[model samples]
Target chain A: MSCNVDDSDEIFDDDDDDCSMEVCTKDSHHSGPSNMPESCYVKLTADDIVKEQRKLIQNVVELTKLPGHTARQLLQEMKWSFENVAVLYYDDQDKLFAKAGISVNGEAIDAVAVRGSSGSFVLDQQTITCQVCLEDFEREEAEKGMSTASGCGHVFCNACWVRHITTQVKEGQAARISCAGETFVEGKRRRCNIILDECFVEELLRGSGGSAEILKKYQTRLIDSYVNNNPTIKWCPATDCTNAIRVTDSFDPSSFDTSVECSDGHVWCFNCLDEPHAPAECSNVKEWRKKCQEDSATSNWLVAYTKDCPNCKVAINKDGGCNHM
Target chain B: MDLKRLKKESVELQEPIEKCGVTASPIKEDLSHWKGYILGPDDTAYAGGKFEIDIVLTSSYPFEPPKMKFNTKIWHPNVSSQTGAICLDILKKEWSPALTIKTALISVQALLAAPEPDDPQDAVVAQEYKSSIEKFKATAKLWTERYAKEGSMESIQPLLDMGFSEEQAKDALLEARGDVQAAVEKLLSGA
Candidate 1:
């Protein structure tokens, strides 16, 4: 597989050509279904995932005319499915925008407005409550008292928001945070997709005097969410390697002959993340390893005492010297 | 990094936990290794037994769920009788940062009251609980009497009055080494 060397180091750039070439050349000797040879495997470095995610976010931004955060909220809600997000977004955009927690054209929630006494019915409904502390800040105090973060439309006191952001960031949860009052409509088991805005979080963290360490963790966690949450990408399992692998299909570990390599000089099976121990199927290899573990204790003892019998080369325990039986 | 928020949060939680009649306190001064006990809920086989729980927290606490284990011998399906490891979801990936030590311990106490036999930490106990509920309850109550009956010995005299052949009772008692539970278990198996 290493024989087909190229000046361009990564499969991420020329995804299809490099992967097909490598897979076909490697598996050429093995006879199988004629159509099955194009192994759609691609490896992506950490930078590649970041670039793709940013590109995706930018694409969303351009399509919806929503700001980066609202686009993020929409994209996250859609689980990065751009087409579905676009469909839902273009259909009843106002409802979709409100659902994505954007109050004013994807801007941060500015205020909770109350109805004017002598009022138009449509604009009459006003007033907002912070979800975290469960406090209602009137129109005058609304700007100072109430702050909204995630796409769940849940608002909180600025102080409470600061604490929440700082603590979650410190806990390596900057990547995934939802409204604290988890009113899960579908179920608790299913992921609550309301993602907090990064800038809002960072701003709040700064307000609460959060250390640089937590902010760094927050940044790392953001990258992690980009790489790890995507079904296509997987962090290279090799210790001390920063690269990630992005396969064309979600590679099943049980499937035969998946040997992929990272840019940082590490080779492994994309399926089980083990060393590419081919010819031996994955399940069989697992069974063999288990058998070795259980048999090694007695095997070690037998190796110490027994010598090969001259007749058939079977291990035989020696009882006495100079006795050929 | 271990945040200072955990200390305040854990301390804040102590009141509500105590209100629930469960004892919870940090074993060490650092508020990392904690020790607590739950008085088994009413009407259950474990009712009157005080079950101890072991808790350990990393410095990255409130961010990470504390590792919890049963220090006392318990016969519940979701608690390992051998290792005392609990299989509760709150102590693992289902953990939310909003959940505090108090809520987590309370959940453990709840697990004792309502054991999820389907998803069990102790399979043997789960099997017994599922297949022979009557026998499982009897044995569980018997264990509670043997191990959790606070300094009280299972008196042999009570068994002597119940008409069992003198030889059988004495032999069972001898085999049990005078422990009422072991003797009862032996006699039940013998029968």
Candidate 2:
């Protein structure tokens, strides 16, 4: 059924009826460019959405053997899809680890081997210099707080990591906290900018210490990554709202005016991110507004060059004695 | 992380640059900014010309690349003539903590010696350099001689004769790097 947006609330007001009541619908068979096969709006209960997300995160964590934050990061990096992550995981895990920017020795840290029987980060007794501070520390100390990129294994001391993380966090560069990775490529020494895994930063902050503000910022960034990375989900654009909605049929680009209200009554267009502006298509509204603003100069010129007729109520040019009704 | 370590790194950077004869000094009382001069590498079109550079370091130094820009006017494929921005890969995405201000400056100098038109900063310069190598070389050399250095003291005589104070003409000549046309504009700008 085409949702008549004039009374859109009534269409979604029946919470008792299961949106999943009908299965496997191929909506909009017209095959025209303007109308797409929009999936029936499935208003999932918030609890069910949370459960599905939790399960997805758990699956990623289990599969990658990465920490919770890093697992979420990886999942988000893959655009919240298991298929992409799984393909990369099986295709060539080394490249994946390098891309993820987590590693100990130029190799992907096999979770089983590292935590075997001990349930700890495996450390071999070797002193290595942290590239940031340029100080040599024991491997045990390295495990506790030192962090390195997965591909280019450059380790930095814990103090340095905390300071750097704090600096980057303050600078609003939470998304790309990686190794200050400089390497040789095609005989030229260049910056690699490999991605740093969230697990390493979390472990460092947890072990060495972190301020509540920084920790909170990291947590917020972690949550935001999901919404920002996933193409089909949107965080409710309401003040103090902690909810996000994921549209199942996210591929419909033509549904720019599709407004979906959250459980909190905060409604926004699913595509264009404005109010539910019915009786006016998104393109028309934009064009009308643009024309009004853009023609101000020409309108002023008209007022300056011509005078309006008094009795007839029509604009009349004084110079040419031209009058219009 | 602390002031002492940061100071140490800055000192380390200064010594290498000075030793290489590419002098750089802290621009302000705080070590946040630096000014550098690289005499365009010899045997290149920009030889005998000095180009000044601005360097800004964030608190996250050694971890992040320092922001560098040319304060002196230059004409080259990789350097933006208007903005004085350089488009070297090492200065950006491929930036590593391992690189110091010295290496970056050296890379820029090397860029003057050999520009990569395939990846260019100023598209016009890149296009000209690619399509006509001789024309590119002539303009680059002319710009080097025209604006890169303080022209001969004798060249200020004409400006001094143009109903201006001796000091004013000399100053304008220095500001304009001896380009007579530019020196006149500099004098007018002052007035």
Candidate 3:
């Protein structure tokens, strides 16, 4: 759904049934102000996020006729916008694939044919050396020990590939882990820019007997990238809360009643992600908060909690709650 | 995994490569800490000087770029004079696993020859390099002679023979930035 503020009133009128009952109750509870605009949002649990991501990926896959992983890459590149992915797939198929770094119709495989011819070699009938580790493996052992990503033919031993993938994933770069093999261009060797697809990463990790913890971490990073890249959704700012709020209608930042509540009863301004302040604008609230922190916060606490000595006129705080003194 | 790749790279670096005079070796038995040496490129202000670099590799060696900074102080637009921090693309965001220590040091050597003043780490040096090319070359050459070149202590002996204390002579020489005539004039003026 588009979040254009001008058409939000009309859209809300036409789809009043789509608003959840919890949002309706929240509107009634916050009926103290007349100028506040009604806002609609849904609280998404952890399972809901996973389900929503899968549903969106499935829609893109069906519409574009691309594989699930490629569809996911396109969605991520497009910031989880199904409409944009569908439209771009029909309008400019090659541009969309190239932008998302997906090889079109196995064309990248063909380009690697010339580059890989010199990088890998067969040594007699017994052994071949892996370029990365510089180790010789038996011919039969090389076949099972070697692995290559989908888009490129530059092969490395399974151990090296696993190490590279795990390191990238550990560093929170799982979203765009590129191939480790270097390509020769104009007699100068440089890194290949082809990204390792998700399917290839998962398969390599599983086939190489990688631990489950690394796979879990990699998947978590992918999910985090999805939420972070999309603008319409934000994780609830409350500590230890895994729930997120997805705004269903257009949100106007100028209006002050953009407060949203999570499943844990934590209320926050959707615009600034701070505590809800109904009358004040977000910028004014930020200025007032900064002013308090800079000028009056400590002195205000002293004034409220301390008493002045009669003779010395020094401010003294009473630590114990004893009435006799 | 990192140890194996580092071991191989360390062994390969032992063989002297021609044309690029950059060498690095582990500081101790631990392969993670290394000391690098780069000979200043010819036909530049930094010529005939040797620059030392301190390199520290993390546990993820090739997958992550090694952190390198100059141990020897040289005046350049892209290197911090106070902290020895270097600003280079290959050392940061553009780093790839294909780049080795020798290649990174070679890039550093090339940075000395051709500096990108517009994108600078030291603003004063960049401004000097931009505003006056001749003055920048003179100061850079003086700094190279005072700091990077060996036998620099012997160059300060002439000022000591003129009745200036050793500390005073060294301070004046540094304040003059290795200009012999300027150091002599400042010592004579007693300012």
Candidate 4:
């Protein structure tokens, strides 16, 4: 059965023309459904995912009057839920900022400024030391060499920052990389919890001469975080498929038909990420697969290597590989 | 980058600042593998013992947390008795580039002072720790004395005082493989 893609007009307005054109071109060749549900799901490419994420970020930016980076940070902290971010932002601005590890009033920055002004200054050539590498740099060098996040004033050398960001992104921590500087809290040095925004991480990586592969990894991780956080969107579980499926309708597990076809025509159950198994519950399929995994190897070995003796009725293995018994 | 940061950290740790009693140095000429020592904190079952730790730093030093495990076995809930695997947050997900090897070792020392039985690496040890604090303390103290205190003869002294001959006590201790209670049981069973 053909499912209309126009039902999700509110979310997929920009892709409407493209989707309708594809529908018209593929309508004649559309095959009959084979026990699959009529769930309304839109297949999304990497570009579509970015556009959707940008749309959500733009909505938050307009609602909160915050910069795009800050808006994106809030959306990410709230798991890309525009409604939750809007509600919390309007409800209690300071609480939301605190929860997201954002310091809008620049209290930390002001504190750093005070400390810098009070510290030693030699002949108008002020030098700052990076805590990570424990090296001193001239004011000019500090500006060119040191990097700090937008909301926080804790600074580290660009080299150290690049290493930190590269390691974090490589380890799949691209979405929520915090500032890797320590700040004095109650006279005790503690890690700064200010999360580095995506734009800042990208600019830093690009400006510091980071590798192109790392930037690509960071972009992929951002898309992954967006898809993973959204309840309606799921990446196709097929091997090497970069496309995703966005189910417009609220998934009802009790109905049990949650299978959808990706753009690559890979049919999979959105609920369990398994192959399309109609008439079998996701839980039952999971148990059956697990049982097969546990016992299949042993059963296969017994069938291949063992034979039952007629008189004793016990399974025996021909260990010597001899034809005559 | 790793070598520079690791060398700087190594130099800074040499200074006795606050003296948390944790020391680490590279084992090989290259600064990849390291040997660390943590003097057990006072007022704990591990007191008066020195715990050796095996540390291996990946190429991404300071960016990635160093891998560390106890080389000297001690009975503790958060440390695996057999594998020396530790269950600490900072060593895993809570690791930050801002933290140094010195700080991580200090955390491990602090972990020895306060064991979290709820989140344990050794299930049997955690069970004993939760079920009976006294028995757990006894086993921990015995392990510290036998393995971490630098001498095995000290563990044989009590058996010697208990009327067993030196050769008999030594054989029983060897047969039990440094387990004091097992050695005592072996001597008593006369097997």
Flag regions of model 4 displaced more than 4 Å: A1-39, A90-95, A103-125, A182-191, A238-241, A263-265, A284-295, A298-325, B15-18, B151-158, B161-188
Query: How well does candidate 2 match the true structure, expressed as C-alpha RMSD?
Result: 13.2
Per-residue accuracy of model 3 over B35-123 as CA lDDT, tens digit each? 98888888999988888899999877677778999999888999988778888866765565656788778878888988989888888
DockQ for model 1? 0.13
Candidate whose lDDT is highest: 4
How big is the positional error of residue A157 in model 4, measured in Å on the Cα after superposition? 0.9
Chain B TM-score, candidates in order: 0.77, 0.74, 0.87, 0.84
Candidate structures ordered by TM-score, highest first:
4, 3, 2, 1
* Candidate 2 residue lDDT tens string, A43-84: 334344444455666677778776554555566667778888
Question: Tens digit of lDDT per residue, candidate 1, span A1-325?
Answer: 0111132123223433333222223444543322222355655666666667666777787787655655766766566778867898778777665555443232222222231110001112255555334446665565545554433344455666555566666555765554332323222221123456666666556555556777777878888866655666677878989877777654555566666666655777665566777767765764466458767876676668887564334668965312313
In candidate 3 the C-alpha lDDT for residue A150 amounts to 50
Q: TM-score of the candidate numbered 3?
A: 0.73
lDDT of residue A175 for candidate 3 = 71
Candidate 3 regions with alpha-carbon error over 4 angstroms: A1-40, A55-66, A82-132, A182-191, A263-265, A287-325, B17-19, B151-181
Position A147, candidate 3: lDDT: 59
Leading candidate by TM-score: 4
Which numbered prediction scores highest in DockQ against the true structure?
4
In model 2, how large is the Cα lDDT of residue B91?
Answer: 73
